[model samples]
Target: MEAVYIDKHYGLVAECKQGSKKACYELYRLYSKAMLNVAYRIVGNIEEAEDVLQESFVDAFAKLKDFRQETTFGLWLKQIVVNRAINLLRKRRLDLTELEDGHLENIVDKEEDDQEEIQYQVAQVKQAIQLLPEGYRIVLSLYLLEGYDHEEIGQILKINENTSRTQFLRAKRKLMEILRQKGNVA
Candidate 1:
């Protein structure tokens, strides 16, 4: 539909949909690096991330006709890539445990005015994220980085919404601990 052309990638995407492999490759060239980064953030391994990216593109192209373009092509493709990456972790048996009542109680909720942004550099923060375990890292990536709320993250991860909130809080605590250990956070 002409309305689908609102996204700039739709031009090449349309050509690809019409069986133009060159256009398809061009679109891949445009999106692969960013897509790979998304996969890497979720999977926490370069090789696995690359494999997942390739698989997601294949799946996306195969199901290309079903893409309604309600959102941009990139957003749609990102969902596929993220799902594939999370599936890989599921195969690894990601364990998202519920927090004890005391832990949640001890975790005082801080208002924005009461919170101070950490002083860590971006690279330091990224390193800390990568060092987190699979469950925590995935929750953190989906919630904080990808802009999904706790309910959406719970739906994606097949966990309770409360579990997502607990994992997010734990992930933040772990990330801050890592930064403190690295002497990156004051």
Candidate 2:
């Protein structure tokens, strides 16, 4: 049996389809902050993330008629936000590609073993994440914070699944390294 998703805000979405300005504003108010954070995680700049948020809302509203209820409105809007943020990053010529497979062969990720031993403050982890390269940060944010699997991340970023896994591992390794260097880990 398929799981049925009952969105509490379905009525508002319906109203939005009918050009109800109040419903539109309500939806925006409900989702904008989370969506902005999503964009910022991928784009790595608050100003650029704001631009992406605004543009995503505009696109979502304009394309509201085409938004079938295959998923919740929030999920749909999130997709738009993520896509727009990624496109903005592309425009800035951010290097997201992984190095050739040969170079990654010897880099074994021991993150799983190390995670149990590390104890760090939330603030330190957040700061360390920010210090990561754009590619690593984006992959890490999407996989860990945004809750996407490597397969989905690969599809979203148009890269190989192995590449996504590699990036995620490298991100975790780098994050731990940063925390250790700062003496934030216990």
Candidate 3:
């Protein structure tokens, strides 16, 4: 069944590449809801999510030629939506900070390996992340929830990799502070 879905997905991409409007519409119908949820997660508003969804499809269609199929079409389209949402957030003058290379290395090294502890931390952290400033919140969402690497985040935000890491660290710190204030931790 999953194989059938994969075949259909690839066929749609091929047809859309061939400029089939029906295929494009089918792709839109298939992915729009999931894409909208992704946009909403980043932008945190229904209206903005709708707008981003439309804009992302437009951008994806426009640049369909560049898509190499190294990953699934859904993943490619999701990246476009995330990039557009981040760009929109930046244009609004959100205060996102960049991290240095050393800092990013430190963070990667410091990440916990224990699954149980990590899950507990992640749950607590997510609650605090919700309280972050808009810039930090969006960055955190893109990096953590959406599984984008710092380099991808940097490209989306027009910053360097270091900046993405720094913002992530700042977001984490701010989240921890918020959690502490709420008495979720010591």
Q: In order, what lDDT does every prediction score?
A: 0.81, 0.82, 0.76
State which candidate, 1 or 2, has the greater lDDT.
2
TM-score of model 1 relative to the true fold?
Answer: 0.78
lDDT of candidate 3 at residue 80, scale 0 to 100: 88
Highest lDDT: which candidate? Answer: 2
**Each prediction's TM-score against the native?**
0.78, 0.81, 0.69
Model 1: per-residue Cα lDDT over 45-130, one tens digit each = 77777899999999999999898888898999998998999999888764333222221111223455433342225545777887
Query: What stretches of model 2 exceed 4 Å from their correct place?
Result: 1-5, 94-120
Q: Best candidate per TM-score, number?
A: 2
lDDT of 3 by residue, 1-186 (tens): 133234448888888899999999999999998898788667765667789999999999999888776778998899889888877786775433321222111112335577556565655555466567876787788888788899988877788899889999998898878888877779
Residue-level lDDT for 14 in candidate 1: 86
Q: lDDT per residue, candidate 2, 77-120, as tens digits? A: 99999999988987886543332222111223346775444422
Stretches of candidate 1 off by over 4 Å are 1-5, 93-120
Q: Rank the candidates by lDDT, best first.
A: 2, 1, 3
lDDT of 3: 0.76
